[model samples]
Target: MSYPTIPAYQTQANGAEKLSREHPVLDFLIDHQEAFDTGKMKTEPYTVFHVDDFVFTKSDGTVLPPGEASWKGLLEGYAPFNKHYHEGRYACIYERNGIWEMVGFANVYANLLVPGEKTKKDQSGRQWDVLVPGAFLFTCVKDPTGPKGFKVKSMTLFGDGVPVVGEMMKRGMVKAEDLVK
Candidate 1:
């Protein structure tokens, strides 16, 4: 299904571009994200800015190990989905004790066009859009030796998985029986 083009977001109080200029780290992060999304970079964003001991905590409190396996797992799980439209709703950057942290939420919708081999028959080849709001918290610090003068220590993602699964089942993207043991 073809989705409408997502318009550029602009904050009325303070433009996001202006803030990015004021915070070079934020600018670098944003630029890197765009480049990665456009296939300009094969490297993941986490490895570029995250420290050696970096961790990713899911909404369920599961802390994935810091390594290539964890990164690959995350990528493979979302390989079937693609973002159809997205718009930033809110974002803020703050500093405390020398750590610069960013918190943001975006309105996102995705399409499950490609189903993996393990996907249920009923869930395959569906042409429907699913609302998938994204919220993230990235904690980092200035690292003179790191890329772009900053390194992330951890990243926490917030989401309600139950509802997403429920929605998928309701829309036939996921079979209810497949979720049962």
Candidate 2:
């Protein structure tokens, strides 16, 4: 079998998977994502979220701030679902003066945890993959107390959730009222 050659420009944009491993901070984040992809978040990436004051905000103005709720909420939400980090392109990634940042577009493949009423399934009743798109910004700061001497302080996820939400609603996995502001 043969594979097509990727252009240099394209390879550079999709270098998240090829980033040099010498940088510990970026490595930390990558490790976390890898753990999530392989369904080992509960054990492997658990400590990556040790930042007690971490904040996660979505593009839709939804915010999960420190003390309001912890990463445990995220764990619970993902506990019932199977997700795999399909691909990502980090348009920008750098570190300076103890701060590390990355901005990129990512796709995650997931399936409905439970069979939905209108879910599209195969003859074997296997649900199809849901490709979730996300444009994200991750900012990390040096923290001696953090598990890796660094921690993710804030994360901003920019994306059009409508498509995925619409799909979910169609599959009977979510209701219109559930997404109401």
Best by lDDT: 2
Steric clashes per prediction = 0, 0
> C-alpha displacement of 21 in model 1, angstroms?
4.6
Q: For candidate 1, lDDT tens digit of each residue in 1-181?
A: 9985433322212332222334665665566445544544345555665576777777777788885554554455445465333344566777777777777665444556543222221122333455566777878788886667887677777766565576567657779888895
Q: Which stretches of candidate 2 lie over 4 Å from their true place?
A: 1-22, 43-47, 67-80, 116-128, 143-149, 177-181
TM-score of each: 0.64, 0.66
**Alpha-carbon shift of residue 66 in model 1 (angstroms):** 2.2
- Badly placed stretches (over 4 Å) of model 1 are 1-21, 39-46, 83-86, 115-128, 144-147, 162-173
Q: Please, what are the lDDT tens digits per residue for candidate 2 over residues 57-152?
A: 757667775633646555544453555453554445676566777675666555656654433333334445555667777778877866567777
